[model samples]
Target: VWSREEEVRHGTYRPQSSAQLKATLGKDGKISAWRTDYVQSGDAEGETSFIYAIPATSRRHFSYQSNQRDGPWRSVNSTQIGFYNESFIDELAQAAGEDPYQFRRKHLAADSRHLKVLDTVAKRAGWGTPLPEGVGRGIAIVESFGTIVAEVIEATVREDGSPQVLKAWAVVDCGTTVNPLNAEAQIAGGMVMGLSSAIGEAITIDKGAVVQSNFNDYNILKLAGAPAVIDVHFIESGAKMGGIGEPGVPPASPALANALFAATGKRIRTLPLMTQAKA
Candidate 1:
């Protein structure tokens, strides 16, 4: 005998744009030009306008399974996310009269997931606490692999634009943790992987051949670049372990990005921060 089951949940929220500037208001008290269409107007005069539009939409799906007739079940999941195009960001920037990063930060602050991660990191890293001048700190987190993980990284940068990984702390809640040691290792390994990506490592192609062939050119984390401290804490629950394989990968990238921003006053958007370290 064989049996199978599947369940899925999805949702989307569209935020409406605010009204245009009062100075640019039409006779009917409504902004006629869509925020996305304002650039063509070339209203470079003293007039400024505001309009709201959707940038990008996201969809998520989750799944679980039970194969045995009387044993425990397991879960397998994935997510597909799409970011807004440059035009969407430009329109949003024009409407808010602020840079895209600032606007996105404001919008992300209102998201429940982002807020949860931010709050957790703030508490974990002692957000308002004092620190030395050369020591820089950053925090970020994400939801994936059926769990939520938050990470905070501390580092220092030299005049030549190289970043040193000093320490990292992570918190995860994926229901009940099946193995404490494994969980700790996963988080620690994740931090090192994140560190390597931030400081060194890249893939290149030349003459239709992969330029970087071995670990000599494509470097992983070395002992010197590894974090001296990695802490992982889990919230206990009677439920089963929701995820154990890849949940640890997402938080470190963003945390490293935030750290780079603090250390160098440079906001990096591309992958492998080392590639743009000089930029």
Candidate 2:
């Protein structure tokens, strides 16, 4: 679904990606192995970010795009890779005809920190609980900068097919939480940024120069479009401290995408969903 022409790109420093992922499942419908090939280029090189597995058997290969104009880079390039792979995991679950949340539980190790955090978000969000018609819930987990974070996003599609997020539940296990309040803020801010990037932000070029000079075209998330509630929880797993700031951003996009898919039968394989999702 992600072709080069469909790749999001423009005059901004933001990167672009082309990804192809394939997996094999056992007779039990559990993912047995996978091979992921993705190419991404930004102002700097971005390798594959992260993947989740129990008995790991997967390979990911990264390549640089020769055409990008180099500038600066982001510390959380993992967000892009995490978004790609995590969404594919949900796709795998759907192919197996299993519930996405429970499917993740089956594939993730039972006693590991990843599962613990995943379970926490599901429980906190009341996974499998009834929702008002037209509302759908999506769950995603990602580990970036060593921190494991899971998120559940509840949203519904507008008449125009744009997703309107209603609520968010996030759980993180990054070892020690020296300051609970600040850590919570970090996660919340990152999640908001991630959602903004996914749902509304886009860049275009005209005559070798960037277009969309004002908010009219270059839109960002507004308060009305934000989730009504964001609940953040922390888990100290007594392991080496990972990171709090960047980990929160990785899982937000995938969770929202999955939520929108649940709300509408259409899957999101494109960004700036405000424009692309109408189809």
Candidate RMSDs in order: 14.5, 5.4
Q: Could you say which candidate leads in lDDT?
A: 2
lDDT of 1 by residue, 1-279 (tens): 221111101111111111121212234332233222111111121211111222332212222231212221111111101011222332334455654334334444363444455456566776656666766666655555556666778877766767776778887767788788988887677667656754676554366344555566766778977878877777654444567656665567666656665666666655556645443
TM-score of each: 0.60, 0.89
Query: Candidate 1: where are CA atoms >4 Å away?
Result: 1-118, 237-240
The true-versus-predicted C-alpha distance at residue 211 of model 1, in Å, is 1.3
Task: Return the clash pairs for model 2, or none.
Answer: none
Quote the positional error of residue 145 for candidate 1 in Å: 1.1
lDDT of 2 at 222: 90
